[model samples]
Target: MSELRKTPLHDIHQSLGAKMVPFGGWHMPVQYSGILDEHRAVREAAGLFDVSHMGEIDIKGPHALDFVQMVTTNDASRLHAGQAQYSLFCNHNGGIVDDTLAYKISDGHYMLCVNASNTEKDFSWIKRQCTPDFDAEVTNVSSHYAQLAIQGPKAVGILNSLADKDLSSIPHFCFDYANLDGIDAMVSRTGYTGEDGFEIYLSPEKAAQLWQSIMKAGEKDGIKPIGLGARDTLRLEMKYSLYGNDISGETSPLEANLGWVVKFHKSDFIGKEALLGQKETGIKKKLVCLIVDGREIPRPGYEVYLDGRNIGLVTSGTKSPSLGRGVAMAYVENGLDKEGQSLQIMIRNKGVEARVINPPFYKKST
Candidate 1:
């Protein structure tokens, strides 16, 4: 068996008594104090996450924009310098290669943040697309940096104390290079927890320092070091899609409820023809949010039933700490994917009642 990789913060996590587990080829922390406590901290105050296991790829050259536009589903031309957009790399058959965040550093330079498990596969797929016709170069730069996420309502104030520049000036989905606690880093106003936060990218050597600094700065704000367990529940509450579970190589972006990122008006892309054809023919199944009627938590691979027939399967599910109810995301037959539609999730050979609901089960009030 291959050995598991450790992030720069692995030792720190151990020092803090975190429960470690293997995740996406890395030895990551599954929980610190506890899943529920950490989850509540993020929703009410602030929480920090070590996300250095994610991959980063850099693309640069004269034809970078053209190459990116051809490879990704989103229109890269729409991004200005210092801005980022959620996008997807699709196969020729319209299946998702991976969903990514594309950062436009300049006209000819861009960065892509991809899932940890799909790093090498995504890099290889991207490199193969760089033919002699396009003057673009792709480089995997994951090892050069470490990432940290400080999330929640109190996140801005905590980060502002250490950031040299006013973090509020960086708008959502945008980033800026700044000095964070004397460490040079790129700070982006983005997060996976569906809360206000910043994702900081810095040298791997400075990661542990920044992590400790942030914890110290947020001591009075009831900040806690969150782990993967809470991270999953947090994103699930917001109905954010997980790369392998919610959407995968077998799923199309349109069917995953990610059509917003698939721009058809732009020039042709990798799966444009297949997607257009699917659009014309109609989507057969769709990803939808389901609120369980009881406490039984629906799990991935659980069968979804309607009228005594299996129609779909749960992709991601959890008992939402914020909503205090069982929630899930699943792909169901298109006609039955309406609001308040009744369905059943087969758990332990017994069907648990569930109902379809619009996503974002929990939203922070303004």
Candidate 2:
């Protein structure tokens, strides 16, 4: 008996004949057709993602803005209603507690989308941080909503066919509530893949219907049901860091190469002081993207070497479906972290030649 939780679309995933697997305490589809097939679908046309397992927390009231400013790196005061910003919450020691998306719904209401693994921890942390004068009311609404990502080049066209709302006006990181055939939903112009797309949040009960509609609308463009394997690859290609894999408590934002996301200018957020200190001290172990020279695929935990001497380990690696080669991101000694420097990855007791490449391995063709 798998102890993992099931989303409302669990049955739908089964009906679609998806190969289910456990992911972060939830039973999710690892693939529908195949990883490569699904990956190509999203890359060439459109693909649907069942991301309902993600956590959503709502922050409400007059002091909501103030509350966010105290917890997150981005200045929440900069966000207007219906806008979303990518941000981070850090521990005092400059370690990333979690990376999150903050969406301002209205004048005093906001929604924070977080990684599923950190839902409880994030909620508890925010609760403790709410001040006596902070008039915000926080609620964990993860189970109340279901999120579907419609991604690819033709995603907008497919989305346009399914809903009445005009998506053209909805710029990136912006969202609006609209009726998807009388099912109240929030549609946001955002996606993990480096392509034009939308993420739809709606009632769990209506998710299957919406999912079917999206596929039908995108039939001409060749939409396919994607899974976690492809999702990971897509985000990796975009150089987007995964929570536990790329950035975690042990990894600081500066070392993870996400220095841009960490806003030090903000007035006193968690980890601000520590991050500033680390920045001045010089980042020692920094994340670097690498491309293996041969057919040998480098996997995570593979030791990295500079001049045949061990210095780091691969944090995340994959046989890049898009690149037809092995690519990985790893924490390496700063002194040996020069881009284009020749390095080695220990794969199966064998040293494989590799080179430090500027992340992301997949660059959009001009």
Candidate 3:
């Protein structure tokens, strides 16, 4: 087997006594103190994460906007400079290539933040689409930057203390260039944990310094370094889809409950025809959220049953630390995905009762 890659913060994670494991071709921290503690910390106070493993691809040229609009499902024409939008790259058959965040730096330049494991593959797929007719150039720029996420109710306050600019002014899904304690970085008001947060992108060399600075600044606020274990649970509680698990190359964004990002009104895109056809024909199955009964945790690949007949399988599942119960996202027969529909998940050969519920098992109190 090939050697696994390590992020710039790998040594720091090791020094902090993090449990390291292989994930998406990188050795990443699975937990620091513990999954439950870190999960609660993010939900209540704040938590930091090293997400440098994610990929960044830069597209630049006069035709960048046209290229971006053709490749992604979302309408890039609505995005102004300094803004980002969640979008998807779909295959010709309407299957997902990868869900991504498209950051519009300017009219001539754009950046795509994609999942770690699909970075190289996505880059190749993107390059193949840039024919001689299109003047855009695609470059994988993942190595040039390191990413850190400070998330939770207290996240903005903590980051504001260290940033030269007011972080609260940056609207959701928008970004700005800022200096944080002498570190030049791009701070985006976005996160996967379904909380108020900022994702800082800075030089790899300054990553450790910025991480330490943020930790110290938020010390009194009860900030903790979170790991992948809690990260999964946090996003799971919010019903956010993970690339490989919840959605894959075989799933369409419409069936995954991500139709909001697919704009059929836009000019032409990769899978426009196929998606339009699917829409006209109606979707046969849909991804739904489930609140599992009792303490039994549903896991990926677990079978879903409706009246003892197999209908689908769980895509992502966990015992939610925030909700204190097992929650899951699964694809089920289209007509049976109602808010109060009843279903069962086969766990350890025994059927566990679960009910289809509207998304987001955990919501912060207002």
In terms of lDDT, the poorest run of 10 residues in model 2 is: 176-185
Clashing pairs in model 3? none
Candidate 2: tens digits of C-alpha lDDT, residues 260-309: 87777777888888888888988889898889999999888899987778
Better of 2 and 3 by lDDT: 3
Deviation in Å, model 3, residue 285 alpha carbon: 1.2
For all candidates in order, the CA lDDT equals 0.95, 0.88, 0.94
Residue pairs in candidate 2 whose N, alpha carbon or C atoms collide under 3 angstroms: none
Residue 63, model 2: Cα distance from true site in angstroms: 1.4
